[model samples]
Target chain A: MITLPDTASPLYEKVKDYILANIGTGRWGKDRKLPSENELVASLGVSRMTVHRALRELTSAGFLIRLQGVGTFIAPPRPQSTLIEINNIAAEIVERGNRHRSEVLVLETIMPTKELALSFEFPKRVSIYHSVVVNFENDLPVQLEERFVNPSLIPDYDKQDFSKTATYDYLMQKTPVTEVEHIISAIPADAETARHLGIDVGACCLFLHRRTWTGAVVATISKLTYAGSRYSLGSRYSPSKSS
Target chain B: MITLPDTASPLYEKVKDYILANIGTGRWGKDRKLPSENELVASLGVSRMTVHRALRELTSAGFLIRLQGVGTFIAPPRPQSTLIEINNIAAEIVERGNRHRSEVLVLETIMPTKELALSFEFPKRVSIYHSVVVNFENDLPVQLEERFVNPSLIPDYDKQDFSKTATYDYLMQKTPVTEVEHIISAIPADAETARHLGIDVGACCLFLHRRTWTGAVVATISKLTYAGSRYSLGSRYSPSKSS
Candidate 1:
C-alpha cells in the first residue's frame, strides 16, 4: 500500500489527493492497479465509507476506473469533445474543475474576403463583422477562435465585450441556429494563428470551421483552432443508424 | 464570355469541363457570379438543356452551388465525413469515382501491453491480434490504420489477407458492432506514420482513435492517421439535439 498523508481537507478529498499525487509522480502509472478499499482503509487509517466515496468520486471524475470483481486501475488521461455538438469553451473548462478565461484579441467590422463571401453566399462588397478570441484553460491558451458574423442578422455584434461573456453564449441568445455545418481538419498553424494560439508556427492544430444558419439566412461563420497537444474531439454512439 | 473547347465526351460533359477549367484556373473564382443559362448556351454553342444538365450534375457532385433565383456560382472544394457514422473507406472512394486499394503491412499475434491489458481487463500474459494496413485512394496514400483485436472475440483475425478485403468489412461480417467510440485529434506525424503516408516527419496529421464494442466485450481498437492535406471530416445537421 502507498503511504499517504493527512490534510485539513475532508477525509475523502485527502484520499483522492494521495492517489492523484502517486499517479502524478508515476509512483503509480497509467493502468496501474490501485490498492483496494480495504487496503486503503488499513494503510491511510480512513473509514471504509470514506474510502468508497473517494473511489467513487475519482471514478466519476475520470481519474480512476473500477471494474466489478477485477479491482480499480488508473484511467488514461483522455479529454473528449463530441464532434457533432457545438460546445461552449468556458463551460467545458469549468466542468473539468479548471479556471476559464477569455482574452479578446480582435473585434471589428471588415469587408468580406472572396472565400468568406462564397461561404456566406453574399456579395463581395458586403461588409461583415469579425472577431478573434482566445480561450484559456487555467491560464494556458487552448483555443483561438476567429468568427465572422452576418451584419444583417446580428447588427450589434461589434458592440459586445467578449471578455465578459462568451460570443457563443451571446449568439445563441440572439438567434437560435436552425442549421449548422462543421468541417474538421488537421492543419499546420500559420504565423498569425500561432501567435494567437501561443503555439509555434507549423505546429499541428485541430481545426473546425463552422457555419450556422437561422432559417434560410446565414447567421455566423467561425474558424476554431486548438493546440494539437492539448485537445481532442470524441463521441460515443450505438451502431443503429450509423456503422 | 469565356472561350472553351469542345471535347469528344458528351456535350454536357464538355460544358462541365469548361466550367471546371475556368474555376481551376481561378478565372471564375469562388463567389464569382456566373453568366446566365442563356449566356452559357450562347457562349458554349450548346443547347440550353445541355447547359442546365451540366450545372445540375455539378451541383449534385458538390462542385457547384445553384442558388434558386440567384443563378449558379463557383463552390469551394470541400470533402466531408460524417463524424457520427463509421464509413467504409473503399465505398467512400468509389463514391467519389476513385479507385481503392489496400496494402497489408503487419498481421500477427502479440502479447498485450500493460495499457492494453488494463483496457481489455485481462492479465498481462494474454495474447491479442494486431494488424497494420495502408489504404490508398487512386494511388495516393491517404490513411494509415493500425488495429488491435481481442483474440477471444475473433479467433481467425490473423488468417485473413487484408489486401484482398478490408478489416472493417470483415469484422462487420463476423461481428456487427453494437457500440462505437471515436476520439479525434491533430498531431505531428512520426517517422513511421509519415513514411506510410508519404509525408514528411513532423507534418500535421489528422488522427482518429476508434474503439468498437460488441455487447459488453471490446471487439476492436484502431489508430487511424491521415495526411493532413488530403482529408477532412464534416457534417451538416439541424440544431435539434446539438448546438
Candidate 2:
C-alpha cells in the first residue's frame, strides 16, 4: 500500500493522490481489480462520503473505473496534460502542478507575401496579424505557439494582455464559435523551434495546429508545439453517442 | 500539391486522403502553412466546393487549421489512436486500410473467489462472469482484453456473441449508461498478454481499465492491454466553459 497524506489535507484529495501514485508506481498490476468502496472507507479511516468523493473524482478524471455489481479497478497510466484548464495555455500549465509563465517573442501585423496571400485566401495587398509566443512551465520552455490572426476578424487583437489571458480564452469569449478544426503531426525540432521549447535539435516534438470559427468567418489560428519527452497524446472512446 | 483523385471516389474523402498523405510523407514541415482552397481548386482542376469539403474534414480531423484573415496552415501532428474505440475493435483495423480479426481465449462464468468477491462487494456465494479475447490488426496480435462482468448486472452476458459485437456496444444498447469511468496506464506485459499482443514479456504495453454504470448501479468492468508500437493515444483540447 502507498503512504497517505497528513490529516490536515483534504481526505478525498489525499486518497485520490495515493491511488494515482500507486498506479503510477505499478503497485497494482494491469487488470487487477481493487477493493470495494466500503473497504476503502474503512482502510483510509475516512468517512464513506469522503472516500466516495475521492473515487468519484478519480473516476471522472480517468484514474479509476467502477462497475455496478463488480468492483472498482486501477486504470492504466497515461500522459499528464501540462495544460488541462478551461483557460488557454498559460492557465493550462499552472493547473498542471507547475509554475506557468510566458514571454512575447513577436507581436505585429504584417502583409502576406504571394505564398501567404495564397495561403490566407486574401488579396495580395491584404495584411494579416502574426504573433509568436514562448510558453514556459516551471521556468522550463516547453511549447512554441506561432499564431496568425485574421485582422478583419479580430481587429483589436493587440489590446488584450496575452500573458494574463490566453488568446484561446479571449477569442472564445469574443466570438461565438460555430466550428473548430485541428491538425496534429510529429516532426523533429528545428533550430528555432528547439531553442524555444528548450529541447535539443532533432528531438521529436508534437505539434497541434488549431483554428476556430464563428459561423463561417474564421476567427483565429495557432501552431502549438511541445517537446516530445515532455508530453504524450491520449483520448478516450465510448460506444455511446459522443458529446 | 496533393494529388486529386480521379473523381471516382468520394470527392471529400479522396481530397482528405491526398492531403493526409502529404502531411504523413513530410511534404509540409512544422509550422508550414498549406495552399488555399482557391489554389487547390485551380491547380487540381477540382471545384472550390470539393477543396473546401476536403479542407473542412481535414480541419475537423485535426489535419489543418484555418485563420479567417490568414491562410490555412498545417497543424502539428500527434500520436495516432489505433485501439481506443468503443465500437467493434475489428472495424477500426479494417477502416485503417488493414485487416482485423479476433480469437476468444476464455469465456465462462465462475464462482467469485475471495479476491473477486471483495473487489465486487459481493458475497462469496455469487458468481462472476469472465472472458479473455485477443484482437489482431493485419494478422498481428495487437491487443488483449480481459474482462469481468457483474452477473447481477448483465445476467445473459454469456449468451452474447462478442465476436460480432463488443460487450461495450451491447451493454450501451441494452442498458443505457448514466456514468462511466476510464483509467489508462503503461505496464510490462505479462506472459499471457505478451503472447496475445505478440510482444516480449516485460515489454511495455498501454493498458486501459474501464467501468460503466446506469445511474448508481454498477454495470461492467474491463481491463484491456495493447501493444504500444501499433497503438498510440491522442485527444483534443478546446478552451471550454468549464475551463
Candidate 3:
C-alpha cells in the first residue's frame, strides 16, 4: 500500500510518484513483478488510463520493464555513466549501490617521449607520472585506466596508494579543475587491455580519451576503457523553455 | 603569411588561433604538414615554447597529429555525434561539410504487438507506422535507422518522401517534442545491418536508442546503429560557476 502525494500535479504524475516511492524505498526489488494496471488503478483510486500512463512512462524512463502477456517487472539496475561529467569510476560505481575496488598495476615516474612531451606541452625529457589502474565493481573488472600526469601540477602524485584512493579523487582534493574535454570512440581491445578486463582479444570496448585542465595548463590526460558488454554511456536532453 | 588576431589572449592562444585560421581557410589541408617549430617561431616572432604549447594543445583537441621525427600534420576530419542533442543525421553530415543522402528500405504500417502496445501505451491491434532508412555520407553507409511512430501523432506519416525530407525533420515540424531520452550501447552488428552498412558481420557498432515525447505521449521510438570503425560520439563539459 502507498499514499500518493497531494499536489497540483496531474493524476498520472501522482501515480508515477507513488510507484517511484515504492521502488526507491526498496519495497519492490529489481526484477520483481509490479502491480498490474487494474491493481494500481484500484489501489490508487485512479482510472485505468492513468495507471497505464504511469507504468508506460516508467518503462520508457528505464525504471520498469513490461513483457508481452506477462506482468510488468522492475528493471535490473544499470550502471549509468554521465556523458557530460568527468566522473571518477569509484564514485560512479558507489553511486549505483555497488562496492568499488581498484588494483594498481603500474605506477612510476618516466621521461616523456617527444610525442608525449608535445601532448603535455612540456619540454623534452621532462619527467611525468604515469599509472595504470583497473577498477572493479564487486570483484568484476569494469574499467582499465591509463593516466599521465604533469609533475608540476601534483608534485607527490607517485606517493599516493591508488588502491585505497582513486587518482581522480586525489586530484580533485588538491586543485580545482577548470575545464574537461572528452573524446569517445568504440575500439577493439588489444591483448593487454583485454587481459586486464578479462575479455577476449579483439572484443569491442568503449574508449574514452579525457583531458583535464587547471586554469589553462593541462593537468592530466587519460585513456579509459570499459567492457562494452557490461557498460553503457548515456545522457538526456530537454529543450529549454526559450526554445 | 597569416596575420594574427590582436587581442589580450595569451601568446600561445594567439598562435593556436593563427594555426586554426590557416586550417579553416584551407591553407593547411588534411594531412598537410605545417611549418616546423623553428619556422613558426621565426615567422610569428614567438618563443619556441609558445609554438610548442599551441601545437600540442591542438593535437590534444583532435585538430592535429604529431609524429615523432616528422613535422606536425592536420588530422583528417572525424564525424562527431553530439551526446546531448537529438540531432538529425542529415543535418549532422551537412554541418561537417559532407554530402548527405538516404535510402529508404522499409516503410509500411504494422500491427502493434503486445510489446509495442506497452511501449506506446496504446491498445493492442492498433496500426503503427514503421520505417527503415539507411543514411549515407558521400555514398558511404554510416547509419541504419529503424523507427516506429505513433500514427495518431502524424496522420500522414507513411506518405512523406523520406529521401527529400527526413522522417525526424517531418516529425519536428508536425509536433512540439517536450522531452528526449537516449540510451547508448555497443553491440555486434547483425548480418542484415552489416550487409547494409557494408561491414563484416560481427563487427562492433555503436547502438543508440532514442525516444521522444510530445507532452506525455510517446511520439517516436528509434534505434540508430553506426559503424564503430567510422564514427565516435563526444560531448564537452565545464563545471558551473556555482559548483
> In lDDT terms, how accurate is model 2?
0.66
Model 1, position B142, has a per-residue lDDT of: 92
Runs with alpha carbons beyond 4 Å of true place in candidate 3: A1-87, A121-125, A241-243, B1-87, B121-125, B241-243
The lowest-lDDT stretch of 10 consecutive residues in candidate 2 chain A is A78-87
Candidate 1 stretches greater than 4 Å from native: A1-86, A239-243, B1-86, B123-125, B241-243
lDDT of 3 by residue, B1-243 (tens): 545778999888899888988886878674488989999998998889889888977885668899978989988653122233235778878889999999999999999778877878775568999999999999999999999998888889999899889887788767656566676677788899999999998788888887777778889888989888987765455542210
| A156-216: candidate 3 lDDT, tens digit per residue | 9999999999987887767667666676677888999999999988788888887777887
Candidate 1 per-residue C-alpha lDDT over A107-138 given as tens digits, one digit per residue, 9 for 90 to 100: 99999889889899885569999999999999
User: Higher lDDT: candidate 2 or 3?
Assistant: 3
**Tens digit of per-residue lDDT, candidate 2, span B173-207:** 45545455665545556798777787777665656
In model 2, the Cα lDDT at residue A107 comes to 81
lDDT of 2 by residue, A54-106 (tens): 77667755667788899888754322112211125565566678887777788
Task: Give the C-alpha miss distance for residue A166 in model 2, angstroms.
Answer: 1.4
What is each candidate's DockQ, to 2 decimals? 0.27, 0.03, 0.21
Q: Which 10 consecutive residues of model 3 chain B have the lowest summed lDDT?
A: B77-86
CAPRI quality level assigned to candidate 2 from its DockQ score: incorrect
